[model samples]
Target: MFDFLRDPQWLWWLGAALALGAIEMLTLDFMFLMLAAGALVAMVAAALGLNLTGQFVLFCLSALVLLFFVRPVLRRRLEESTPLAVTNAAALTGRDALVAEPVTELAGTVKLHGEIWSARPQWDGETFAVGERVRIARIDGATARIERLPA
Candidate 1:
């Protein structure tokens, strides 16, 4: 009754595309996005009566092409459009900190971004009184080297 029927990939291809797209969203990279595009291409091939082997071949070829060629262009464009954000310990540099204890050259504590941080003055005799606002000079290991802001 259905002699023309061949590959049944309606749900398979659609599911693969959705799954890859979701992963791409999490990773924010174009790798899985290219695979999703390939899945869509294979979905079209399947709808056109291509066999499973042909669908698979097209999917691989399309995915490789998109990954190597299209992905770079897309990723570069996106990076060019967005400004880079500082992160990690480097992000704490030059930020304000609230002294939670009397900070001396040796040791103390401060509230940095709602978290308590071990702090020290940059100079040998510099000291920060409790409730003083100091600037983070740099992060050394687990400690934040602080400096008094210019008067």
Candidate 2:
């Protein structure tokens, strides 16, 4: 059983590659996948009967090349294929809201996208009545800057 370990180093390398590949699936970063590729190269070196030092060198070179050259390309492609999603305050911009309380330039309240938020008028001396519709101008701290819709 243990006799195979003495002569067939490829088995160890192949096992390492498989383990790294498994870890890569959980991370999704592609770093461990590149290491698994290096381990596969080392397995090939072992099958070719290269000395331990030569196999290690080949593995190192393969890992470095893949990390520097292939990894960036793969990451960029992955980024490009994924859709950009807006959330939180960014998603609130340009949306309509209803005044929950009379809104003056200083402070008030509004129901924006189903949530009550602290709000202020967009311009000096501007005001909104309760039940009035307003457009969100921007967000500042915890407050939404709102402008009354044209009648």
Candidate 3:
């Protein structure tokens, strides 16, 4: 492994790029893609006969440039992408969730989108029966604050 670092082949840099990209699939955060681009640039530098130190420096510069300058522009462009049809929990304002079990005045749980989540009625003191429909008020950490839906 360390020997490959000394050799600094283009394939090694390309492999690093691919590995970073693969990890991004699980994380879904946009940070890794920048590093991947950097690795690709380093690979090209290595192909051009640059030494390992030069390749590493090129990679660091590429990553820094992408993160500081390119990332914000790309993020802005992607922000206007077509909205997902399904409402993610983070986007769950005014959405409805079914109560899978009775909600006591303090706390309870509900089923939404095939997932069980801790829930609480919006008002200071309230209780809800099972099978009732509730409107999502807001989410606090892992808990969903909700209220009984209007008939």
Candidate 4:
């Protein structure tokens, strides 16, 4: 009726694995999950009547193997599955910009996304007056290539 009281090491290991797994849900770092896997290996060893030392050895070995070998592959697979997010200059394309200084064929300045930037007209003959609204064609190095807004 009280067999667990005589031999409870496996139950202790199972408890540890469950605790680590619960921590994994909060952290999402995968470290606790790997440790949980190790604890489970130790739990299995205990259930098979292995001594404490053997169970510990299995836990350490399995944890190291899973952390080093499996973790990288899992991280890489997740990153590969997700598409890259557009940022910085790439994200600025097609967005609106306000001409801060008179823009001409050669050079000018514009306020884009709250930051002042060097700008140029998309066409050589075009020009933008101060405070004129424009559309960003693309980013050229540190400069913004701008076009006129529709009337």
**How accurate locally, in lDDT, is each candidate?**
0.91, 0.92, 0.85, 0.92
Ranking by lDDT: 4, 2, 1, 3
Candidate 2 TM-score, true structure as reference: 0.81
Count the clashes in each prediction.
0, 0, 0, 0
For model 3, residues 22-94, the per-residue Cα lDDT tens digits are: 9978876668999999999999888777989999999999999999898888877787785757656668868
Mind giving the per-residue lDDT tens digits that candidate 2 earns over 39-98? 999998888789889999999999999999999999999999999998888888889999
Q: How far is candidate 3 from the true structure (C-alpha RMSD, Å)?
A: 8.4
How does each model score on TM-score?
A: 0.63, 0.81, 0.52, 0.64
lDDT of 4 by residue, 25-128 (tens): 99987899999999999998888788999999999999999999998888889889989999989999999999999998787999998999999998779999
Candidate 1 Cα deviation (angstroms), residue 44: 2.0
| Model 1 error, position 57 (Å) | 3.2
Candidate 1 C-alpha lDDT tens digits along 32-110:
9999999999988887778889989999999999999999999999999998899999999999999999998777999
Off by over 4 Å in 2: 1-7, 149-151
Candidate 3: regions farther than 4 A off: 1-8, 82-151
Model 4 scores a C-alpha lDDT of: 0.92
